[model samples]
Target: MNIIELFEELKIDKNNILLASPEDIIRIEKQINVEKRINPDIDVNVANNLILALKDYRQELYFIASNRILYTLFSKKNYSRHHFPPLQREYDAEKIQSFINQFLNDDLVLYFDQNLSQNKFDMINDIFDFKNCFPEDALFQLNKKLNIKLDSVLVNLSQNNSENNSAISYVEYRSFYVLLSYFSSIEMDDKIRSLVNIVSERYNANKLSDFYTTCISSMQGYVAFDPGLTSILVRNREAAVSNSIERSSSGSSSGMSGKSIFFIVIAVLKVLFLFAKCSSH
Candidate 1:
């Protein structure tokens, strides 16, 4: 398997690794080192970068994932309607907002590291600098109340798919499809793999295009989101809250609880922190 494929395989178990025990972390490291030793040609740098893009920066990754998923779902719809998918369906922007809020909360450990003032407007703006997949003039009402500017580079759901369509494919963004599939998960929505393929076929970047096409071909085969993801995240959040409350009520050692939650949070957030450690001018 190529680097992208191998990283894809590793990405599948991100959340599992995120919540692993201390000994499990050690075992995982050993297994990974063993695999690298067995495969001399494996691009360890790319594999490590893929992990940074997919698993690290929990808040940032989810923010990007939600935007990209929303762009995919709502871009083609009538921006004036604001009904999300089907007009007759019950979905709407309010539900979307709720999902973002619930899913983006800290893993119940940020409060310890620092204060949680929760004003992410600046961070949101910075992320959009790298990518904003929303359609032009999309979510007009939603964007008006929210202080955010969104101009789409690619993936314009506003336009129908065709030769003239500039939506969803670009050389600079070629790497994103590979990362998105892993972030959303293959089992969640199989459409991701197809979307990755579509982007792969758009060889508009000249010489750079050939390099990316090869990368995409090597990375083929993967997948999702919908109301299903929203529901799943909501349930997970509720359960986490209930568990936290129970532990607190049980009079468990605060030291143990803090250590456990802190460990998971650091494990998940570490790579992204290192990835962006070198600030760009």
Candidate 2:
């Protein structure tokens, strides 16, 4: 569908037409707010898809305009009260699904050139072996199976243009950090981290200590912060290691005893205290 048609189908504001026009960037600047007004409860991906569609329609100065569009869509004004997730593949399916489905409508439309039902069967079979499934998986896998293009038109717009707008570059940097924070929640995947680093370096935002801190904080139930805004990425790793070590030490699968558990808890608390004290410095 054309940009305007897609917006209409999605029930987004007609104001988005002005936003999608390539004549100027003014309309794109107001898009996030307009989107909020038109559908305050829209899903994050739907909002992202809309912005991407608009940028694609504008078709100007690829990366710069696409970055600007993303900035407009995900500014502090838009996302401070309501955080949207970055695209990441390593997340637990259920958690990722929750984020994806948060603003989703039951009747949300999926556009494709082929019937997706066939591949859904194979995907369901293959994914069950992993013992986990996400609501989006069936469709994503089906798209993969059918060679359906899941192209975002704006992503094509974000090509290297040589001419750099400092403002747009800054927005790109922010978007990269936001993406990093969103993806870090998933089980830390090397590929995802590498992508974040690439985007960070590309936007000259390699110093992302604060961003990591925010990501750790977003990891609910994990006391994963340091005063210097250093992340607990290692802490989770260490916990996993400790669990393995304890499992090995115990030898049997029955579980640890009350006395052993007490001692282990004490040791953990002491280690945490020591780590906290060391971090304070």
Candidate 3:
């Protein structure tokens, strides 16, 4: 089905849907037969799906839109004679950034040192010029927000990874691993593999390798967090809270009689703690 149909079928609120440009909406609308104009203020049901689709297809869309914008800019007669616009006429970085921020709101970054290959590990040192490229303040915020412990080893690894791989592919792999390392069990692995397979098939990939390559190449930055365990945490948040409340209530009741509630509370707290820790990573 078309995007609009999918959205309508899912009853997504239009306001929750953010776009980088009106042109983007127009383009998508043309590609898909949207029976009615999407009212930004009234639609929200499919916001999650929309966000997921956009992220899963981000690099492809980003590259396409960037190239298109560049082409449009250069296609004009005075292109080379003047400086580039602060932003392109049809590009809205803020809107895109907002979408990004919203997408990442529910997710956390996970790091894995052991899963990284040696060559991949070393390339991090060569690519990123720390002084010129990365935003120090943003990086600091990222570290603080995600509880990422920045060290020479991690920095060295990232820089080296950036240098060794092709510009497009390098960032893609890094993003993939950054998301992948969060999966800790065979079940999560299966989910990832299934999602990858679905993405590959949707994109009409001929081989598993090709599908994986394209999937990562296209969707790198769009993936804000590892959804494997975090999704479970989100789904169970209310239940977790309810269980805690129940334990607390039980504790209050038992404290007057026996130590039953105290043990139950401790057990519940331990489980909650484990869930939180797993979800956080």
Candidate 4:
């Protein structure tokens, strides 16, 4: 199939298209390279797949980021009080998603892809094991899991882009910090501290400091999700991080507690695989 036809089959539309033209693709990629320059270890394999899954993975973040942010805004600018104000073509679908793509690509998206490859996923293995035969295996893992879940709700803040034109909402990040807490240590805390500092500075969001302080103060460790949920590119799960959000159709959220966080983690896992499935195709 030609590129245009392939994109159409992928259900590409004006709203989701970051690459409106060949030039757009090149410009987006240059943005990815800047991150690699800063952190050489970061694998930007997502860019390789961006061309492939323009509609695939987004790395899976767009759905989560967009749902939290724009759902209410896009629900209707038609309202007056307590509603999004009149948009001046600044908040259209393409620009909004594009903004998310650019913001995530910088340091957040690949950061997630790189981190997931870390040993943290072993915890998810514990969770996914479900261990029907040994239900405790998954049940065995809830303590650390739930703590990190608390951290996620408290720490994560999602906005579609840097322009500050999109909506910002509390979204769930990747649930790997439980691993740091489970195996608490100087190195883990230090690594996350560096990341949090960078993320906080880039986004100019203070919630991250909550994570940074908590994470370093003790082995409490913070919960941060995959920003690549709104990022571009694809990395081979095997070669990059072993693998890798919510809201696009997360349906709705109720009370958030350790119990709720537990369900959220599983939900995130389902979403991750959903993206993985898209990548496979």
Task: Assess every candidate by TM-score.
Answer: 0.21, 0.20, 0.19, 0.21
lDDT tens digits by residue: candidate 1, 1-281:
33234533444353343355556645645555777788776567644643444444333333332333332221222223232223222334343343333332221123211211232333233223222232223323223322111123224422424443333233223233233332343232333323232432342222133333343333332122333323322332233344346556877633134543443234224323332342231
What TM-score does prediction 1 earn? 0.21
Q: Could you give the C-alpha RMSD of every candidate to the true structure, in order shown?
A: 27.9, 21.0, 23.1, 22.0
**At residue 258, what lDDT does model 1 achieve?**
52
Query: lDDT (CA) for every model shown?
Result: 0.34, 0.33, 0.35, 0.34
User: Tens digits of per-residue lDDT for model 4 on 1-281?
Assistant: 22222222333343545435667656645655664577564445544454544544342323322332232221221223333223222233444344334433333233233334442444343423211212233233444444454354334423324333112111213344444444333333334433333332332223223332232222222432332321111111111111101212334332123442343234334445545554576
Candidate 2 residues 1-281, lDDT tens each? Answer: 22222344444433334354554334543564566577656455665655654554332212111232222222212223123233223535564334323322132213111223322222223223322323465444433432221122113214433243222222222222222232232222222232223222332222123332232222222222221112333342333334445556878544434443343334334445544565476
**Candidate 1 Cα errors over 4 Å, as ranges:** 1-4, 47-281
Candidate 2 Cα outliers beyond 4 Å, as residue runs: 2-59, 64-233, 248-250, 254-281
Candidate 3 per-residue C-alpha lDDT over 1-281 given as tens digits, one digit per residue, 9 for 90 to 100: 22333544443333334343556555544433343355444234444334445545454324222332322221221234133324333544444434333432222111113223322422222212221222334334443432222122234334534353343243234444343333235433333333333333332222223423343343332222445433332222233333335546766522222242243234334435444565576
| C-alpha positional error of residue 37 in candidate 2 after TM-score superposition, expressed in Å | 33
Candidate 1 clash pair list: 75-157, 155-167, 155-168, 189-224
Best by TM-score: 1
Error of 1 at 248 (Å): 76
In candidate 4, stretches whose alpha carbon ends up further than 4 angstroms from where it belongs are 1-19, 39-41, 46-61, 69-281
lDDT of 4 at 177: 45
